[model samples]
Target chain A: MSIPRWAWVPFGVALALLAVPILGLLVRAPWTRLPELLTSERALDALGLSLASCVVSTLLVLIIGTPTALVLARSTGRWTGWVRTLVTVPMVLPPVVAGLALLTTLGRRGLLGQHLSVVGIEIGFTTAAVVVAQTFVALPFLVVSLEGAIRTAGGDYERAAAHLGASPTRTFLTVTMPVLAPAVASGTALAFARALGEFGATLTFAGSLQGVTRTLPLEIYLLRETDTDLALALAVVLLAVAAVIVGLSQRLRGAHG
Target chain B: MTQRLALLVAGAALILPLAACSPAPDGPTVFAASSLSGVLPGIEPEASYSFDGSSGLVDQIAGGAPADVFASADQRTMERAVSEGLIDGEPRMFATNHLVLIVAKDNPAGVTGFDASLDGVKLVVCATEVPCGAATQRLAEANGLTLMPVSEETKVADVLGKVVSGEADAGLVYATDAAGSDAVEAIDVPGAEDDPNTYWVAVVKGAAHAEAARAYVDSLVGEWGDDLQHFGFGPPL
Candidate 1:
């Protein structure tokens, strides 16, 4: 099929806009110093912390978000619209605002936090806070993607299974889940990527502390202030990791399709 | 043809408003450190100001940002800018600041002094890259104390925010910042007086509004002394 001339204008514009920055990163990256910079204790620490927290948050998103997505998919009411809107609010809200919202509700002096503090338990500035910030921001990605998948898959198969003496739970577990596996895998990857890049919310809510809350983005921001070259190297690392995950997920989807 | 024209008109409608909202090219764009945020507003309310960490400002200036004046919270950053040929001339010292430990108004942690022995108290401080962070390091080294901060924030305002929100028990911030906010109380560090963090102001090369930038810098260096003093900043030495 021949592409229209006008379409190429916008397509080329979008391609150049996206590709130029990545090209710039490749051209300006301190290739010689990258080995030393990536191996530095601070860089490694941030990488380890980011991977661990993002993995935990992705699992949390899958567990909690799957049910929320399923509910939104099955329901058809005014309340469902409001519920879906509420679930996607964090995805649209500024990350810093999300952090402040979390802080006000979970900080030591926060409304719910004050009660928790009374029990001699603190959540702020802990590894748990990092997971909370990540999950809060990433849950929407999983839920939105899975809800779309569930809606597209429809309920015909599940209904047919139910009429044939299959229980609702069994039909969901055996039939609905397998059909949504590719969507789940893709959504998990996107959520994990989003969580890994989380900065403002993590910094504001969990605080930037090494081995606890200082993730890769926070480390890159700090390094940008002190060492630009090292910051570039770390950014390249993040770019590589995100690209690999996205690429793998696309391949998985293709295979499943 | 009509559809393409409509699309073109819609695009122009979007771009025109954004272009109008941008800072006027004729106005003096001042890139000042976040620590000077309080005083700069009082000094030159008309000039467009970009307030952030000095290093970030330096990076922006180096990247050819159209800034007229650069006010840094520390000499080291200004010196770096000069060495990089980002600024036009020598930077002049405009003001000085001392580090102080700040706590929430309620004093939830009961932080009395700047010593390291306050066990179990969660403290926050500026990251070492910024001026306030460097001053914090100097203060710690001089007093032979090891600070156990829960967070090393990018800027002084962030440290103040954490303290004001009671997320942190205490934070080491500029005397001006501590005095500027009623939500937090400042505790004077003993040796902080000896190592004052000086503010430096310089004009950027190829500034569009050079005269206006110079006047703004002069106001901060001369006429704004009383206002700076009121805001708890030390007189330029």
Candidate 2:
């Protein structure tokens, strides 16, 4: 059945709001001059860095954030409320502050950094620092989304499965996790996209060295150095990459459903 | 049903126009260096502002951004802005800044002097895209050092951040800026003599608010010159 006209208005308004940015993107796409801009060195370094960091960060989130999600999902104490809030801290923190926090905790002079300095190992302003900054921000998005799914899957599913003939780990790996597949895909995709576009923290902590720490956002920023058309061109690519992730997420979610 | 529908319709009406464009109040557009923001309120230029890298401001002006006034962190950028005819007349050099090698008060690598420097220090600088970076590069090269910076930040503040955050052993930043931060302490090297920093202000061409821009430029000459110099800039024009 069709939704009522008035009810559809908010949806329409939301679409309009979203459309404005897309329209600006299209209007300023630098379409005719696309080929020359796309192949430039800054474009390549940024695109590579963006991809590498997103991949590494998504891997880290899945590795570390999943266990945290599991713990939060299973716990129902009153502290869970506060824990839930804490999980979202990075999402709200300004990217610059997040970078500062990372550096203070892990830079060469950082609390841990001073110790690592003896070993001659430094973390900040490196490619590895880029990964750390991205993971710091994106992990929360994945964790929160995954925890919600794990909660919805509920203990009952696992408990009954355990009684029937499955181990707890087996039930989690098979029935519970398979059922939560759609959420996992969606969360990972969201986290990946966020990691890809992250700028301030990366610039602050990773130290924008071309072909080293210079991610796509930095490249786009650096693009304003010589060419706004190229900057606009980079923006177009960023939009495209984001759109692809969003599309893949939807398609995979549809399949999972 | 009617109440829900009425609320939705009213909400849509209110948000639709609001999202498109709000009414704007009038103001001149002063494009300035991001460093200027640290003390913009004191000068009270009669305009709205978009503060960013000194080079970014110069680029925007050259690219025909609708800026009425331009203030930059160093002579290189302001001079270039004037050369492009993006600025109207002789830009007055009103203030000076100095570069320092800042470290976290805790100090990591125990970096001391630049003339004894090499390409290996964990240094940070403003990218050559901005004027501070340009000044930084000049200073490093002048000291007979080849800097292998860990990062090249867009703004001088970010370079300072590298030091404060302990990301780098040292960063080249404005001494006045280092004074404002608890995260960093200045290490003066003997070679800073040749790299005296300066700031220049100019009215942009095709400014819609020429009168305001002129008044602001005039302020920089004597009275305002002293204020800038008080902030550790060199002597007034």
Candidate 3:
């Protein structure tokens, strides 16, 4: 394929900007210290906890946000816009504010917070809260992306299949869903990448603990104090993992495209 | 006329960048804790405060954030800067606060003492990284008790919130903070002093407005700095 001559300037510039940061991550990644860091039990524990929380957070967001996106995609009027705007509130609010708001509403002494103690159900300061916080911040990304895809897709395919006697659920499964799969997959990948890197809200809403609530990003932050090299090493690892998932998602999108 | 529309567009173009970059002149840009608001001068004659998390303030200092002066909730962050050579002079202990366990005022937990914060009791603590959280953890360790909290909050205020909101049965926070809450009752948590003492101060290194910054620091350390001690923050420097 022949490329346009004028496209090279901006395209090359954008590529350079993107590649420079990755190159820096490579140059300063502390490759030689990998053996020493990889051996530590605490490092393993922190990584495991981070993976567990990000997965649960992504799953919870998907379960709740998927239906919410469907409604937002189909609704009309000022009310729909307001509800859609409200759904995106977490994405706009500072993560710390979201954490504080969560605390005020769900903390031990909150309006509903007091009732939790009576049932012996505690949601703050644990692994579960880490998931909750990550989900709270990350769900909107998936919701917005999927909702946009669905709105652009329109409902005609499902409606046509239904007119031919296929059930609403069946038409959705067979016709409308296949086209939206790319958006769903990409949304999941974006949410996963975001959840993997979430720090402020997690730290604010879910306290960092070595084996308890300390996610990889939290560990990287704490490590910045006593161990700069080790912290950089963790950053490289986090970058690498997020990159691979993003790469896979792009490949999936391309195959579908 | 198209000329008026052009002038309006020109006006908006000129104002937009300046509006984006400038801080409002109304406030002091004071960075302190919510708990300290009541005890401090509350308002300077000229400037208003922009309260923020203590760790955030220290990070801002390290990152060359613009500020007149900084007042942290704990000494560790101030010391972190001192060790890193980011700040100018020594940071003194401006106030001291004991640890307290906060519960909903309704007392629905039927709780009374440190025992309520033990295992099986839902508790909220600052993540071990922050000063208050470390204090809570150290107190727990000194008492030979292990508390697996329901969640760990990044800021002390979040821990206070977990208790204030009733999400956790009890939360460990500074006594000064607990005292400020009407909906939450404070139970004296023993052995928090065994942990390192939290210090607050006014250290403005690389300040944009050095004169105003120095004045703020000066008022915080002198004999006139009695309001800090009066609020039970500890003996003022």
Q: Report every candidate's CA lDDT.
A: 0.87, 0.78, 0.72
DockQ, cand. 2? 0.40
Q: What is the lDDT of residue B222 in candidate 2?
A: 53
Residue B121 lDDT, candidate 1, scale 0-100: 92
| Candidate 2: tens digits of C-alpha lDDT, residues A144-248 | 988987876667778889899998789878887778888888889989999998998888778899888989898778767657798899899989989999898
Give the TM-score comparing model 3 with the true structure, all chains together.
Answer: 0.74
True-vs-predicted CA distance for residue A213, candidate 2, Å: 1.8
Q: iRMS values in order, in angstroms?
A: 5.6, 4.3, 10.9
- Residues A54-151 of candidate 3 have per-residue lDDT tens digits of 88989988888777787888788889888888878888888778877777677655567668856976676678878888898889888998898888
Q: Which candidate is the best by TM-score?
A: 1
| lDDT tens digits, residue span B5-28, model 2 | 676556556665654452332556
True contacts kept of each: 0.43, 0.50, 0.29
Q: Name the lDDT value of residue B72 in candidate 2.
A: 85
What is candidate 2's TM-score against the reference? 0.83
Candidate 3 lDDT over residue span B1-237, tens digit each: 465445444544553465358564533355665567776654354655656676666666676556666777777777766776666566655566778878877767676778733557667776675667677777887877778776665567767765665556678887777767787988777776545366566656666666776666666666334565556565543
Question: Which CAPRI tier for candidate 1?
Answer: acceptable
- On the 0 to 100 scale, the lDDT of residue A255 in model 2 is 69
Q: What TM-score, computed on C-alpha atoms, does each candidate reach?
A: 0.93, 0.83, 0.74
